[model samples]
Target chain A: MATLELRRLRKRYAGGAEVLHDIELNIDHGEMIVVVGPSGCGKSTLLRMVAGLETISSGEIVINGECVNAQEPAERDIAMVFQNYALYPHMSVFDNLAYSLKNRRTPKDEISRRVNETAQLLDIAALLDRKPRQLSGGQRQRVAMGRAVIRQPQVFLFDEPLSNLDASLRVQMRQDIRALQKRLDITSLYVTHDQTEAMTMADRLVVMNAGRIEQIGTPMTLFRKPATRFVAGFIGSPAMNFLSGNAGDLPGWLPRVPEETTEPLTGDISIGIRPEHIALTTPNAGQIDGHIELVEPLGSESLVHVRPTGHESRLVVRHVGTEQPDAGQRTGLNLQGPFHLFDHHGQRLATRPRLADTTCSMEP
Target chain B: MRYHRPGLDVAAHTLLIIGALAFMLPVILAVLASTQSPGTLFSGTLPLSFGTSGLDHYMTLLTEPVRGVGVPAWRLMLNSLLMALGIAVGKLTIAMLAAYALVFFRFPFRRCCFWLIFMTLMLPIEVRIVPTYGVVAELGLLDSYPGLVLPLLASATATFLFRQFFLTLPPELMEAARIDGAGPWRFFIDILLPLSRTNIAALFVIMFIYGWNQYLWPLVTITSADHATLVTSLKRLTIATDGTPPWHLATAMTVLALLPPVVVIILMQRWFIKGLVDTEK
Candidate 1:
């Protein structure tokens, strides 16, 4: 319903430490962007700034092509659902939903109608008379959502709205939120530290680290083509493994690198291969050989941890019940699929360049 | 359910019974003495038996006007009630708003303002009675209900108690309301006020008693009998009478003065405990 643009957004505290650097992002109408990051990554601060709950230290926030940097939260025509389900504890579910409309001077009958519709949509009609404390966690979460949706604002902001729910409820609410968002076709910006939620629910994922955007793209695109060493290791469950080596040696261990990158051979390279991309083969059958250190069976697929010869860090392999290597057994790892390679500065180096690229060589 | 200890139970029950009797003895003796004439009190032994003149003495105390005391009993009771209610309601309003501002707003020198209010806790009306009386007199609030109520309005304990409650409130609620288009006044009336009802009730009980028991301030502030509280009027009934202590109507007035606070405590025993301990929401 609305497009949101953050132009060179930055947040600096009074103590002179910048918590969020110039974060530039643009969202199309009806797009759901999930900002995923670690705890101190400033994702929540960014969301709050968009919600107008936090003051912007610099830059502009434009919603629906109208600059709202100086506007109040209510004046921004946005509604937010909080992680703790911040439904008013003293108000009934119906009153909670009706609060914003009543404040806007909506007709009483119209307010009641909208509340009823939202309650029915959220499947919380039976809970309208109950106080927040009387309801269960998931029920309260629905009421929180209902409160926001009843306003029918142009944009919705969710700050880890499912973080407090149980794991099963979290999964259920995740799908419910996505379905609701699509059904209403409302623009949303959801923030969470859970990568799975980001991958499953986001139309685009904005991966952040240490106050900066590491990468922003679709989940699969970011998964397959990460832009930095941080994004490569962050977006996956059993995070991508990085092996440090020279570019000339990448074709031997990680065949994902292209040929003819004859940069100075002394430059260090961080080669990343996802755990699932590596295959288990007999010793002497592949380019790299290692001894299995542990086997973790995860029902569908088992993660095999191996200590590659001459390397101190252990590399993991995902196997689908085939060629399961045991403890202290010698195995060969075939990393013939696509992988990520970064330089010492953590910026991703080019792969599949038609000719020798100057970017990798410019790292020095 | 936690344990089964017969000896401890017996010891505890026995000690509690003796303690209860020890506390109730003075009130019981006062009730019995109010039914008797002043001569029986001079007989040296405490009266254990009820007297025949109970209704007569109470009726006279309620209906008849006493010498040297300018106000009647019922009017004095009315004034006391008004003063206590006014003080309780007034203090709660001021303290709750002060606490709400202190907890929710970020202003310059907010901590300084809070500590200044907190410093008033050390100086009760009894300690600063003269100065407070001087201010009240200068303002011409003397001999008025506002005079009785205004000087003792500010309550640091109630303010801090409400401040603690407001601090425990999650900040997300405020943000959600803000996002819901609730201005500050709407949020306070619709959200904060209802949330603070229990704390207000508890503080009301405590403050009402505090205002009801104001003896020194009322003595210093109110020279007119029309404005005297029941607590101050109770002193007028103590005739001394060659140190025999009249003992009859004096006991009746004492009983009357003690009833309101005791009734309040018993009526709100549950909320009183919750308010005092603050162990629940």
Candidate 2:
């Protein structure tokens, strides 16, 4: 019955710049929700608000069955891991982990037990007595995680915890965090600007844009059916390629809607298709054609950038192989994936396009 | 170091040695003169050789301490020690908490408050000594240690230094402590104080010396022998109402007054250097 709910949460500065607007979320017990967006998206602000580090302008935050809006962070029974790994430079790793427990007046023996268990869990037992300055970046990150875990708090707040590490270390720590969060089954709210981290680590991803929730769902659901054009463009890697065509079907689009149809997509409607969804076909063989501009072969899969024959916009196709066409080649792009169409207002089109007749199973 | 000229290096070394000896000559002269007869002072010719009566002079000042112009030597030294330690600790306490408030907490007109405190630095005890003395007398603290220490604490130099240091501390540490269930004071004592060790040590040395060298305020305010400080007493020991002052006894008192400050600096030198260097780093 454990639950964390954010109802009508809003944040505005004294200058009346609203940074978070109507953020409504229900995070059940043991759920790991990663709030992700571009810079200045207020994702970190939302997390800090829930952690009681920032005040909510007008809202109620319910943890379990109690409203903790006015409670101090310590009384709220939550823990936070910061981006800089804010380890106390003076204390050893052991003391860092034992800090909260010690502050709570936990018995000395219990403090040692909890610190030892957390260090062992994070595989940092050997570095227990070393100062934070003595450890490497990855080790410090682990200690930060251990500090949060030692308290056994009801919720965990992470503010871009892996953003400071090297590339390889970032990847490793992402897995470590996900595994640890699952093992503890702690209700956690993680924030990051990296789409990959959001997708890989989140049980449910909250997509924010310009101070509002664009969409919230599992990573697979958001990837397959992004509710808004921004979500579609932001969810996938290399971002979903967007093309605005004239009233008619643009290049790389299936010619499903008849020219004299009763209702048609009008008024600057845009199409969103993932780069991996577009496939390469022979010249003039596919539903639409384009001229290949650049082909970036990344060993296993290649990204082929093409300027559609009819529209001035360029689209990318994630071709899955070492073999790919070169630049300046005339090719047909198969418009076969789940097509996302946005209206002139950038809202997702309510109905999926009935263009499956011309689609092929090009799932390479 | 990269472009060292042999001749210039030799010339520079010779100049620095001469400068070092030049600075030491006055101290050496005072010591030699203090060893001679008590009456040998301010004469056209100065004594260069040491006399055998140096111990007798210091003993006279420390034990016999000429009748009634000042307090006993041991009592004056104790008073000075208490005053120095009190001021050093008091300034640090007030400065650290004030800097904490100025840096970590947001209030109305915090900048205005900091600037107002900073304005006091220009008005040392010298400029406002009369007003300060009246205030002390009004409060019935003319001969109290608090009177001596409180006025000095109003200076903002240490507060400014600490504010700069506290500003450099990552804000996340505060947030982290807050999340860890540490209240403001707990955070200060547990984490902030530990991190500020070197800075505190350095401030202790400087404040001790400043407190030890305070002669004007003590001389003006402390009219009793009970609260007479070492520096003021040394000055009083130099004057004679009816005859030439005793040079040997005055110099011996000066030499005794220098010991505590030098000892403090020597003890805290390591932390002083490390704290100053590592803070910005």
Candidate 3:
């Protein structure tokens, strides 16, 4: 177990074009930090740098209080699970898990003991003698996990390990991975493009966009109070709705806008609210009126798409059960308390602090 | 599924049958001549008759010697096998290592080196024959096995095929091995090489056939009769005196020289086609 600290970590190609810029993060021992982003956001690049598969263009990576930027992957004492489950296709499961120990020249008995224990823990003991091609996707994923477990490295790096499995298997394996990580108490960094996986798995979530960290917090903290407009839009399923409305038009539910705004709201000031936070009421009982455009019933919950009058923005509301207003039906939308407001530059703006004792306050 | 045009299929089959027979006619003639007596050869009276059906001519050719050569036929067979094995193994191993380096590693001028090597494939060996002969003689390797084997060791065709094959492999496999504490050499030998057995087998068969049928290079290099390979020795046996040739014995010796490459092709016919098809993909 070790604390991994990356101070001003940077990466660039040989011609000096930067891919990752000025990354600073500290991962405490036994913490699972899930890095989530879009495809070209450099999450995988950052993981590869930590695993020593890629060269760091600058900055120091310290593992367990020792700088490991100059060390080889093997010398850095870390293990990784790849998205394809990169098991040696020709080797049996036993040999696949035993390879690292064999490379280190561990005694035969010790290697067998460790491999058997890992297989039992992963519930893949029956598959020990089978080649990787013979196993299904989920079984192959377990074999990949077993290969990393037997080594018991100081940190485990996962690069979308569950992305290759089917939907049901992905959920099962995700839970299994979290449970295993907790039981072993290993420091881990997991990279994925799926926000749900990051939300459900990480002790801390790092939301990235365009090679920069947009926000870093607990999963609920990110959901409740995103630091930037990009993080707010990138962390949710239907994505937070952004309405180009004047701050002064929000009526009395919102606090009064500062007279001399430190960061002036020019052009289009954006207001963001989660889909589930918007409520439907009688036509005259709410602040804004819109007509329902589409209704998607997801059994337990429904999504209502609304087009507000005199505004080009489309708002989505999460309604419960199968009960939903018909398309073209006029309805009212009430903004939940303390919505996120952003300036034209997409940076979050300051709002008045909520009353501490108000139980219905939106600040989490 | 059946073709919609029956007439076109029938025409296609007819053309294919004629082409197939055209290809098989020479081999059929060679086999028929190998069984005929030396006296009946070149009579052109009855080419495929069963009159002389025994292996008597094959026995005579195997035991007898050409008048000027003074060497039995078995010695020529041994020399050919040795040369073919040496050249095949040498070329395949060197091509594999070079292809592995070009595919996996990063170094200065790597692309330049690959292009230089690949450019050799466009230049025919016949164009460089005189310069190659001079270099072989200056190195004092004329009339030697090293002289025959070393010049053919670097095969751009084989290197290009293997490099293209290696390029399609997913990089994640190599990355997994690195994270598992395997070094570059270990990762290649343990992971990449095992997955490439089909390719190696395919290259082996192709290189073997090429070395077995080689005529021009060996003809220019070897001067002594003892150092001559099978094809050159067979040529010496066929040029007889009195402007008349012993067609039966000459055909038998030709069959002997063709046997190994034929057997290799039959055994690995599937892999040979696979190698060619994989290159296009």
Residue lDDT tens for model 1, B1-281: 44589898899899999999999999999889888876777787866988767756667667877434676677778888899989888999999899989998999999999999999999988888888888988999988888888998999999999999999989988898888888888888888998887777778889989988888878877888788788887887775645655668778887888888888777777775664563322
B33-115 in candidate 2: lDDT tens per residue?
A: 77887545556566689876867777787787455455568888888999999889999999999999999999999999999
Supply candidate 1's per-residue lDDT for A310.
Answer: 76
> Worst lDDT window (10 residues) for model 1 chain B?
B272-281
Candidate 1 Cα outliers beyond 4 Å, as residue runs: A246-266, A353-364, B241-244, B270-281
TM-score of each: 0.94, 0.93, 0.91
Q: Write the per-residue lDDT of candidate 1 for residues A1-364, one digit (tens) a residue.
A: 8999999999999899999999999999999999999999999999999999888999999999999999999999998999998888777888989988988999999988899899999999998898887889999889989988987889999999999999999999999999999999999999999999999999999999999999999999999889999999999989998888765554345453654233333467787888987878888676678999999988778899998887788988888874456788999877655657788878777666444332222111
| TM-score of candidate 3 against the unseen true structure | 0.91
**Per-residue accuracy of model 2 over A8-64 as CA lDDT, tens digit each:** 999999899999999999999999999999999999999989889998899899999
Q: Model-by-model lDDT, in order?
A: 0.85, 0.85, 0.84
Looking at candidate 1, what is the lDDT of residue A354?
40
* Chain A TM-score values for every predicted structure, listed in order: 0.92, 0.93, 0.92
Give the winner by lDDT: 1 or 3.
1
Top candidate, metric DockQ: 1
TM-score of chain B of each: 0.91, 0.90, 0.88
Which regions in candidate 3 have their CA more than 4 angstroms from the true location? A245-269, A356-364, B1-20, B49-53, B64-68, B269-281
* Model 3: lDDT to the true structure: 0.84
lDDT of 3 by residue, B129-187 (tens): 89988999999999888998778778999899889988987788788888787888898
